[model samples]
Target: MKVVLINPPHTAIGSRIPDDHLPPLGLLCIGGPLIDAGFAVALIDADLSDMPLNRIVEEAANREPDVVMLGHSGSSSAHATVVALCGALKQRLSDLIIVYGGVHPTYHWDEILRDSPCIDIIVRGEGEQTVVDLMRTLKAQGDLHAVRGIAFRDPQDSAKVVETPAAYMIRNLDEHRIGWELIDHSSYSYWGGKRAVVLQFSRGCPYLCNYCGQRGYWTQWRHRDPVKLAREIGRLHREHGVELINFADELPTGSRRMWRTFLEALIAENVPVLLVGSTRAGDIVRDADILHLYRQAGVIRFLLGIEAYSEATLTQIRKGASVHEDRQAIQLMRQHGIISMATYVVGFEEERDVDLWRSLRHLLRYDPDQIQLLYLTPHRWTPFYKTAEHRQVIQTDTRRWDYKHQVLATRHMPPWRLFLWFKSIELILQLRPKALYRLLGHPDAVFRQSMRWYSEMGRRTWLREVFEFMFKTVRVREGQSLKTFLGPTLEAREYALEKAKPANSARRIIPLTESR
Candidate 1:
């Protein structure tokens, strides 16, 4: 069977930031299982390749795949591109089966099935085993209804939705296959200009921060066996010659037992690799030894979601910890000689301009190695979504939903002004090279950090950007003129809209594997 897996072009939301990061690791995970089942598999990371929609369709038509599989990160706007691409594929090859999978499909499967007639199956939850089972069924001409964790449209009516029972999560990690050969390491790099290859040590997040869909999706934390994870890391380095790894798991620091063992395994393997990715704040402090291990295990940096400084806001968001903890975590990482990248959300509900300033002041208190300020995104099916719906706070369109563009108007502040505020602050941050240098000074640190910033920013290009956004753009907030944009609303606006939908539809195929 010939199967083509695609990471659809993501122009709708992620395009604002121009760096084409790593290929969709989700698709790569599924690719292994399909290949193991004797299916001819090809992966097209359209997001990285920048392939035109028509060109993608034409290429698949040329391949004449038995099954044309497309994957997405569940951004509704981006999903539209996937839908359009799938529709085009179906038009070109009517007999070809089309499948979709990812975060959006797990919760919104019924809606996706109802809306997208082009998609044949929606694989809910993890893709490794589910997708393999799907391909096997197609190969044997078996009943599609028997496949677990799949939702499909009723053929007889084409109006109703049918759902299979939940697919049991895979517990034994060794049974799963990681297909590294499908990816060409030379083709990928991290969004921030590191030549990075990625891996997942665990699946599922246990925390219930209201702003996140991760905890909601997996519902329970499940980790890959430590030995298997270490072996795979060794394999990625040895076989692929890839030097950098981003552990794209929900939280690599989640397990004391698993993380410690995995670290020891990697140490024993003696592979020199630079690892980076997101980790929770509280978890970092709780596991200081794990942080030490991460440094030894080649973890150069970690991006932690601090979210907010106000305890009231933190409690409102159900972050399970405090803002002080967020700072402590960064300090701990710094102490352990790991660079701390702090990510915060601004413009959450009831957040005024004053509140934004407070948060920014709070953030600067840590003197983070790097700071990423993002607008709060109220994605579909999250607790934030329900709350936004109840408050009548959702934004209306594509422009407003942009992560860079503030979309929602609060009772106190206007949305566009909030956007300008964030842009202005971002501009200042971009331009304050001297101020940043002073704050981040260590002779080697200053030199290496500046080079990295310059490399990622295209040699003072970020400085140029600061001048343009700051000088050219005029922002009006509640009809008030300000010298610059504000910061508290810089991140925590709960009414924020998503650039893409994360809705999961029926007929998505998950990857599966049984043979070791």
Candidate 2:
């Protein structure tokens, strides 16, 4: 059997602004197992070159593969694109098998199967093991009902959707290696054009942040063998000439002891690769003693999920961290010579102008080396979705549902005012004298370059967003409610978590004909 994995191009500013690209880690992960299982596998990273939909269809059709798997890291935002691309591919090749998977499809499988006939199957949760099993079953022309962790159109009645039992979580992450040979290393780069790749030391988050879908989608927190991961990092550095590793993990430092051991092992390997990733602020505070190990192990920066400055908001979202700890974590990282990026999410609460002002003031006081302002994007699978279900949606287009865009309407402020506040806050934060000084005059040359590169990209993105907002972007005045737009919530259908339930338990499938 032949398989071609497609990483659909994304419209997010981050994807468009960067001069370099990172390999699609998700596709490559499943590709590894398929290759080891003796199936021919190839990767067409359309996002790498931002290929057009027609070109993507042409390329995939030319390959004439038995199965075409499609996914994106920014699944919700890229979903429409995936649908269009798959539709086009099916037009070109009528008998092609199209499989879709990601955070969005994992939760919204019912809606997808009902609406998108171009998609043959939706692989829920983790796909490393599921893809292998699925492909083998397809090769044997066996019943798809026998495959776990998947949803497909019923053979007898194409209108009906059948979701098989959830696949057991792969207890050991090292069981399948990434298919590094799938891509040329020289083409990808990050942190000022240094050859880079996205790697994950762990999966899922232990914290129960109400607004996050990661905890539910990933099922539970798990990590690769610390020493083995370190060794793999070393090998990538030595053989592939990878200079920077952008961790795709939600929280790499969830386990302090395991994280420490990984750091020590990486240091022992003497690899000089730069490491950058996101982690909770509390984790940084917890690892205060081993901060030196992080710096020595090539961790140049850590983006802390500050989420909000107000204690009330933090408690409301169940962020599991206090404002004090957030402040302290930034200081600790700075003291250890590691750059700290505080990610402050907007719209977590219904913010008035005064609230925005207060949030900006708090951010200035925290004094992180960098800041990322994102909007609160509620996924149906997350707890926060239910809370915000009654709110009016401003952006009806699913493509703009990425955290970069404002989705829900604000009762206290108009869309224009909210956008102005966002731009103003971002401008003030980035143009602050302290941030400017670091971008131009940081003592470490590497850090200086990184800051400068980020500033340039941010500036471009800022201008592009302004242009789009003024001329291109559209928002409805009186849109449908969140629940009405997204349909019913699917929080209970968490596939990975369902693995622990009894076999005789009720199936989690919800048919399209059921009342919303």
lDDT of 1 by residue, 69-104 (tens): 777663554666777888888888888898888775
Q: Give the winner by TM-score.
A: 2
Report backbone clashes per prediction: 44, 0
Q: lDDT score, residue 284, model 1?
A: 86
Candidate no. 1 TM-score: 0.84
Write down the lDDT that model 1 would get: 0.67
What's the TM for model 2? 0.98
What number of backbone clashes does candidate 2 have, counting pairs of residues 3 or more apart or in separate chains? Answer: 0
Each prediction's whole-model lDDT (CA): 0.67, 0.89
Stretches of candidate 2 above 4 Å error? 495-511
lDDT of 2 by residue, 1-516 (tens): 889999999998789987978899999999999999999998999999999999998888788899999999999999999999999999998999999998889888888988888999999889999999999999999988888889898887776788788777777999998999999999999988999999999998888898887888888889999999999999999998999999999999999999999999999999889999999888998899999999999998999888887888899999899999999999998888788888888887888999999989999999998888998898888878888889999998888888888899999999889889888988998999999998998898878887888888889889999998899889999999999998767667643445464646333445666544
- Which is the leading candidate under lDDT? 2
TM-score of each: 0.84, 0.98
